[model samples]
Target: MGQFKVIVVGAGPVGLVLAIALQKSGIDFVVVEQRKQVPPPTAFGIFLWPHILRIFHQLGLYEDMQSIGQVMTKLENRSSTGEHLEISNSFELLEFAHGYPTMLFDRRTFAEVLMKNLKRSDQLVKTNKKVTNITTRKDGVTVDFADGTSERGSIVVGADGVWSTVRDFMRERAPPGLFSEGPNPFIAPYQGLFFRVPRPESLKPGQTVYVHQPNKQLMALVTATEAHMTTYERVPDVSERTYFSPNKVTDEDVKYWFDVPVNEQITFKDLWDDKVMGGKVNHDEGVIPWWHWDRLVLVGDSVHKVECSMSPFRGAGARCGIEGVISLVNKLNRTLNSNPDPSRQDLSRAFTAYQVEREPAARLWVHVSRLDIDLYTSKAGPASKAATFADGRTIPIVANSPVLDILPFPDEKEGVVPWRRHPKADGQSKDVKARL
Candidate 1:
């Protein structure tokens, strides 16, 4: 490639964060989104776990987030009929494990903040640009939009997401037995409707409540003025797990699981009735072996789909994508420092490093999330109840442990940790310091 420019397809949270980071570095990059404009973000709340918060701190937005986001201190549990189960100091546990509280912010607020502070001009974030084709040549990659327009860059990133067209660009280059989509290692053992509704007067602010039945569940996050809720039920796995499009789901389709009891005051139907925003999406999970082939690299839901969770942080989608972006970019920076621009081999090394460092952590999150789904949907027999209680007691202990201890990264350099729930104070924020 003659010039070092990055063409990023999709302007999701992860993509925007990458764009912002690139803009701050004065790198040449363009972001494309399929939507025509920034819409009011969906009602889901994005919970930034401690690990991701440190990433934001490096991005220079942590303090700003702390000021605007709601801080969660506890997660209360109950039976489907509103019988109280137990309350755990979830936020406190995270704080004890890391040095920061888990914060809850509307997805829309986060998007706006990223867009506002991005050093690039608004036009740099293109909209209504659905990528139709990706053509990689000896020199560079060309991205064709639905509007008969195209852009070329040194490399095209498939940040476009799960149904990513950029992923198709690598089909010819993909190594044997390394197709990005294949026998899905991850499966959906549950499905549900997620909703956003007004916060109830009776619910405590900044507190999360989870109501569960053997085959049904309800989770709500109460803010100062609104609530975001989701209800999941034990559903047999579909042959095709991921919901490829919004059109795949509809209001009529969501009614099948509508009668499950959520609380004394509300059932699934009642929750749906009061919902201001809602949608049905399957919680599919998987990890891809071929994250990159030749010039194409994936970010976000394209290559790795984490288990769905009522707690936003647990899904680990956005945070993982951000990690991918940082890892890829840092590797590229090292390569570029040695050469004006990297060759194909250099790009391959970077992509490999990105996947190697991230794969184990992604697997760990999905494994734990699967356990969560199993525990919630399993027959609530006395033994199961005891296990749930045991888990509640162990969550903090697990959180307090060093993250790298469990999910080891391939290349752990001095002064930088891959990710830690609790890090040695001396090495804390080492990555942030180096990047900033």
Candidate 2:
């Protein structure tokens, strides 16, 4: 069999997007995923920022998304007492940064769209193939799967989720078994119950309603085509003796929290009784550090995991995927263009560039995501009050430059162009009469 140019592990959003990008660049690659098929139950919703929307446009999916998802026009933060603390319309501010408006979409639908485009490229993705081991040689890397199958590639991209086998392989090359502890203060397992209930009449359309009871709990009603409600409360200890199971909270648990009479229509039992509805809520309290040795990288939740904060932005993960793909591809392109007979040193340099460019951004995002969680979940106190107030306001923290800025396009004189103007738009200008 011919040597594969690149092997991407995981068929999640990041891996799929990377595969499409590679295909567009005329690169030979394969995506291997452990799952037999795409997951169901519309895991959750994702808010796509402008940069992410630009990507969808590039893939000819922007219009398709607009047809399905809701365009989020405003973001409002309020206290439990119903006082509006802060309000901003991202459509007005972020439009200047990215050409498109921010969008909210169901995760399952987003994945389906990506898969629809990928269906045209048969053999681009292989499912039910789990990577068990990866070994780097003088020339390239060899990937061994759970089924005793092996494949070799010049490079392996670990788009796999947090527990990545590729990252594990590279970690083995580092100081033996180094692992970091959890970041957040240990809280009891947070049991969460999520349901796509009919749009509650009390909730306004196109708005996200959050109800927080000091020290008791937080419930967020996100308005989508349907109302997506999630109720979270911290459990003191998760021993077997607890009244509720972390694995799955029952309808009775929901009744106790809401303190509402169980009716045929209003009961949590009715809500999660469907096979698709209810499950145990696991406890997690940390953002795990993600780093690896030569020739391997991690992205998305595979790098950091945290509870959902009120940020209402899901494009961050997509942005990480885009950064990883561009960093690795640009390095590979540079090496191939510069060296006719590239040595190991050349490959190492490329890998170093990838790490240097992407690691800081990855770490910063982890910090920001964690901070958001801490503020939202803090118990009722002066600290919590301050956090609540701060949530509504956008402080100009960066006086000089924005905390996040898109990098400038590479110099054209250097024979590198990271972006190009639309040819149609360019040609349209030529049709105009010359000015006197």
Candidate 3:
């Protein structure tokens, strides 16, 4: 086994997923979370696209996820005036194309599934430890925490969210010209209010709805037990786009959106009255041009964010973050296989290759999601036209998703769109791999 270890900061879904992948590859690692507990409780629902579900299948966690989540199959689009505009089976088409359902569940349950499956989670995850500083050397990196403790490892992975302290450290410690991006890589294009309520008997399980208004848009996803709703309000072109600190919904703000119609049958107030949890936040949109420098690297929202509420196709933020994690771990495994203790240059090369393979896809999602938000806020086009994915860009992206190189990919019957085979998966031919 390699003597080097990785220190993962932030114990969100992205960080926990990294811990699992590292353990499966026999790599030594530890996860440090700033929060008092991992996966901090939340009422918001999380959506896992088919491509991400395939990775869960490879990890043997798909069944666990399926047990607690509902498969989303249909979406209904409505106008603020209570007109049923259209009903699209885009999710159904996606399932048929990729052979895996789009799963939706409470965010906390998803994190719990990842944490419970880790064989050494008690030892691998540390809570209530916040990173205060990061020190990198020729041989390794040392991370100092607020508790006056430190952990030394071969490298530091910043899985923290957008306002990342580790990212700040990278800017402070790097050579003057190493990074050209400004302090704020993301901008607040829209403001959002989200809440969840008990699922109404009238709504079907796994049904999602989108309501488009003049300058605002709303989406509601109904799971087995709860219905989570998010309303996006456009920030006027003349208004300043600044990040707003998260806070509870104020009476005035709630009153402004209260009478807004979510459907012909229900208004925002009807759901808000029975809300279990609710909050407000600004939707930041953008991807960093660079993801790594020397021994320190970034993952997840620390580098890229397409706020989940803004997109019609959800979970781009978490999905891209996890994709980056898997790519990073795969590259790390390949490097350590040849040399137990890879040099700084060796690690730098690996980080660079990871950014090359993953950044473009992330950037594309940022652009695609921005367009989605724009289309919704502007109320310009056929709302249901972009919903189908069987013949769109979603199909190609799902088909070409990456899997762990060291493990066999789980078998499933071929769908309309066959997955691009990996050379190392199921002993596929290099020619087939080249074609992919």
Candidate 4:
């Protein structure tokens, strides 16, 4: 059997999680990041559902995650004027059904836990190693970094977020008309600003609050020590919505959002004054039709960039990305276990299976996420009435969670919402064989 080393790009939560999954699978892998450090101490709060927690349980990181993560129980919806709209304990009910609570915590803390659990993290993860280009050969693939170093691996996984250099490299090698939106495809209809502050006395831990107003929306997830907050506002001009690079929040934007009322107790200004760390962001949304070609594949925001927890989807974007990792790793484990020295055809079969399972799922969530943004930002919707949660639409999606195929399924309690085992993981599925 030939040496099989997977090259993983980016070191965010999804990337780190991918590394750990690869490690647990007994697969050789390396992770490279453009940043100076592994967990760069950025990003706001994120929510993880039971589907992902199942995988974490198998990986032995669930206990650590529970230690740091706040088990979110209830969601409170309110108007800009502090009027109570509707309160839903759907999350608590989901916990009862799935045996795992929906967890909310700082993104950096999540990254830290993922990195800490990797036994060979020091040797496997490389920092400040930006990918400049890629070359695919008949035998394997080679990744070129900005630092003028290079690494050869059996396959490359792009966990890089939106504006992924690996995705750009794939575009360069793809045939004409492969990418629908040309080079930069993501649409930035809404602008986002987020930060973390000490949990307000009025707000208790484990409470997720949403304040809805016309063309503006605010979401705050209160953890033990802090409340991670995020706000989204529609960009007045459609042309300015397409972002190619990082765009900082202007002083005017900050001032405008600061004055916006969040219930009657406090305004954004109060949160801004107490912020520990915060920044502006362009909320880009898109799902590419194809996610892999030859020896290169993509994951996370690199392929499908969806709305965050600020939307009704509750960070379905990240959750979906994590599932993509599991799906991809599961296929790779099967292929390598069957034939360690897999031909390009064998590898392509695995990649095709991975994309086939994930692409449609990503497209669906992206569409739903867009609808969520429209509901709140449109004058006829949230401006007039309180936004409602679509439990029927979201619950089914969560119930059908996938786990690792090579490992034994952890014994877990199933709630009212049944957890459907992934068909592909079972030997019954012919999707991969048909593709081959």
Candidate 5:
């Protein structure tokens, strides 16, 4: 591996995937993650669009993911008053890009597959290495950890989630005007709670139910497994303090909102214990202001925080992983391919290209996500519903945009395998059809 090295902070999917790609490119790298162990009882599910699925397929983990996740074929939107408004089969749009199917999977299960794939490479990927500081000089970069360990690398990637220390360090060193403007202002005020419950038999597998109520609120249910149901409801921002605070949530906080009498027997844990869900109650409250600076760059939640409304269609953090890997790979291949010596100029060019290609898409995703939230939170009335539907035109249909083409760098027909193959998933293809 010589002296050339790349340091990837955060052992989350994006960081690990980037390390895998770097290793395959014959680049030496190490991953640093804060968590000592993977958390149990998955927190939420991700809807992997066709483009993202293509990336997973290329990584050769599509079969493994299929074994654990459901492929969502249809998306239904219903008014809170119980009127079906729009129904679209996402698969049809995906067919134009490739035959690759869209999927919804438990986040933990997906991360587990990525982690298993990463573990095969002992020389790469390091966990529990919490990065405390990152310094870049003329020669190389140095990453200091909380445990008093330090490693030198030719480049450092900040895949750490929002509030990234790496991003802060880069900003301090970056020349003025080098980074993009701060995130856009919030267009609306909304909040929500995530609940998990036993799946009712009436809910078909792979079906997503969206309800818009007369109160200008939204509730969504996603069916993952025969026994699991994930539910979320939009509430006024004013009520956020009651639900988001660590203090115990009382029945009074949710009682007036429900049509039926509040279930005194049910506690917050009872709703979220068996199922995976996240909302304002679980996420950090802040906006991700920037993505890249000089030798350091960020990916996933570290650079862009997504709203819940867009989650069902947006693979949020996963999309960031795919984009980061592609952008980083392209930059590496272009800059360091001929000469292994990583100069300041080489690092600068790579980071610049990455930001140029990725920032627009990131901003657009944020905008569309906000729009979805606003539409779902608008006052409920026939006129309001009509106006809401009319407003949908403003939401950019990213599925049809050319930005998606920017993904899947190098444009290869087959997906890349980041790790050695494991035991083939038996009957996985059969299950894919069954679930869809």
Candidate 6:
């Protein structure tokens, strides 16, 4: 019953950030979320990279996030026996290299900040309105919700996450050979269990630590209120079976993975039993083949999902989603401006442009993330021994080198995305806006 230029189909970090960006660009948009209410607290924390930090700064969220999020100043990797494999003064290098220290913030706090910033005169986010279908017409697109309500918009952005409904719609309408020809490209082979608990005394607040094993890994990070942990063990039978669907995983099912040494004094099970806050849940990983089709496009986990580091943020879900929208918004600014009465073909071209810009970076990250996982879980091998070197000295300098610049080659700016041209490119330059 309402008209808008852009309809964002998710209220996660990416969708909310897109709404904020569109509003700042003076574009009319609305966000739809399936959840009826705010979800329960998660044992998830984010370790934002430099380019991620720079975008936060662009959006005027840097300082506010700094206040709520802790500045992560060091990087240390250790063995299950508490032996340091590689340790470095990461804060100085991060700050000197990117002008921003890596940040550690609980997912709840980060999401709250984004939600608060989007609060305005108009209700931009409509919850419990699960999008069931998206139909494209000559005029634009129509999105129908499960509740029997509908809205019309010039475009629909499927920020609905890794298992995206909009993505399904796009695939159904995809031209021959448009995407890959195979099993779910978006869901990776690895599955993980995670939860948050009261911060343990052994782990310093704001610090992230990973204890490695060749077959499995135990990862932890501490925030002001809670500590988060996760495990990524190899599953040999994954190729034949589908572990992509939601599993009502119990602690006992994953007890073997977390029953390891955190230090000399405490065991992971002790923490799990004493103070765990959320149920242990399993999520899939992998980069998808396609991002957009005609009036519909995907962002965040919907397009690409990877295990970048041992932790949740390691998947880099937050940053990927935010960057995806910024790219889309930028392309839209040009396409919509040039053709006020844009055709379906015109919108398709615009969608293709967005995918072209974001796909390379996202694909590269997932590829390298496969390597990151190999290193973190290596018990013994050339790659494992090399990555396990002290300060990574014995290994090829590449191990210690800047990843954003090197491994994910062809990055616009090495190590950091120092500046974002979208908000300004969209002609909303009073203050260039973007976000997480």
Give all TM-scores, in the order shown.
0.83, 0.72, 0.92, 0.91, 0.75, 0.83
lDDT of 6 by residue, 144-252 (tens): 9999999789889988776677887877778867765443554435556666778778777777667777767777777776777776776652422243222345677
Clash count (model 2, backbone only) = 3
Top candidate by TM-score: 3
TM-score of 2: 0.72
Give per-model CA RMSD. Answer: 5.7, 8.3, 4.1, 4.1, 8.7, 6.0
Ranking by lDDT: 3, 4, 1, 6, 5, 2
Q: TM-score of predicted model 6?
A: 0.83
Q: How many residue pairs clash in each candidate?
A: 0, 3, 0, 1, 7, 4
**Range of the 10 consecutive residues with the lowest summed lDDT in candidate 6:** 399-408
Q: Give the Å error, residue 143, model 2.
A: 1.8
Model 4 misplaced regions, further than 4 Å: 236-251, 381-389, 422-436
Which candidate's lDDT is highest? 3
Candidate no. 3 TM-score: 0.92
Q: What is the lDDT of residue 156 in candidate 1?
A: 81
Global lDDT of each model? Answer: 0.66, 0.53, 0.79, 0.77, 0.55, 0.64
TM-score-better candidate, 4 vs 5: 4
Model 5 over residues 249-279: C-alpha lDDT tens digits? 4445555344421122322234444443433
lDDT of 4 by residue, 1-436 (tens): 2678899999988998899878877778899999999787764777788778877887788889988999887778777767787787877777887778888868877888998999879989999898888889888988988899998999999999877788888888889777654655677778778778998887788887887777778888888899888888887533233432223445576776666666568887888788877777777777887888888999998898885335534577788899999989889877976777788899989999998888877877777666766776666536323224544466677777677765555466677767887433454224323322
lDDT of candidate 5 vs native?
0.55
**Clash pairs, model 2 backbone:** 162-302, 247-280, 248-280
lDDT value, residue 58 of candidate 5: 57
What residue pairs clash in candidate 1, if any at all? none
RMSD (CA, Å), candidate 3 to true, equals: 4.1
What is the C-alpha lDDT profile of model 3 across 1-436, one tens digit per residue?
1477999999988999999988877778999999898788675777888888888888788889999999997888877767788887878878888889888878888889999999879888999898988988888999999999999999999998887878888888777766544666677677877788998877678898887876677888998889988877777432233443334787687676677677666787788888888888777777777778779999999888878344437568888888889899888877886677899899988999999988888877777776666666665643446543312765676788777887666575357888884527344233223322
> What lDDT tens digits, residue by residue, belong to model 1 across residues 59-161?
6777778777888877777765556777777577666655556777888888888887776548788888888787777777888889989888878888877
Clashing pairs in 3: none
